[model samples]
Target: MKILKLEIKQKPFDDILSGKKYFERREIKPSNVIDYVSFIVDGKEYEKEEDVPEGDSEVMVKAKSYDRLKLVTGEYKGKRPYLMVEVKDAHVEFLYDENGDFIVGVEKGKEYAIAHIVFELGNVVEIFKGEK
Candidate 1:
């Protein structure tokens, strides 16, 4: 199973840990065009729309199958606090401008959205406080 590690802030982390947040969303950066907005799994990059595997999820961007999401409190270290949780689903959404219209463009190649990434939250596998 592919495990995606992400450094998250405190409030959101707490919400996820407490079962308040059901999914996590990441805004696509301007620096990364649609083609570049992707996830690297096992040395392979899932960048294209057809590349990410979808399991019957109705999302603008098909959800990639990630087994676990390793969330870190801050910079990842040898013994830092981390939360490993089962990833129920993952997907990407398009970007909308101030007018609410869909914002699409070509950068290096054809692409979609500003890149809204959605990773559905699942059961918590492990939570390490990082205290030694």
Candidate 2:
């Protein structure tokens, strides 16, 4: 499995840490083979890999999940994933963005099928406080 090193903003980072945000949305999807995504604060970097934590401190999830979301408009349809993911073990159905032009969210009461890949994350994993 490939590892993706991402730099995220402070607010999103805080949301992840606080459990307010479960998924990280992106315009471009990462490779399906990625099983671990290591995140660093927008301007921070880690020098040693060994310093990263393991086990319960991290949240394990599927790497990639695909779905087709029915748009609010009955005449149109949108692709799912909008890069949605569940944080830790929490269960979240779908994500919606009012500004999005495509599929914004799932249809009122319909069930949508989703696909998933294997991945893991945590509060602190080999975090190095420095510019990337």
- TM-scores of all models? 0.64, 0.28
Candidate 1: Cα lDDT at 120: 87
Once fitted onto the true fold, the runs of candidate 1 whose alpha carbons sit more than 4 angstroms away are: 30-61, 75-78, 98-100, 104-112
lDDT of 2 by residue, 17-130 (tens): 465764554432233223232323333333333434553453322323222111111112342111122233212223344764333323355432232322233333233233
lDDT of each: 0.71, 0.34
Give per-residue lDDT, candidate 2, residue 34: 32
Output the worst ten-in-a-row residue range by lDDT, candidate 1: 30-39
Model 1 clash tally, residue pairs:
3
Q: Model 2 clash pairs?
A: 52-126, 59-121, 62-117, 63-117, 63-118, 65-115
State the TM-score for model 1.
0.64
Clash pairs for candidate 1: 63-90, 95-113, 95-114
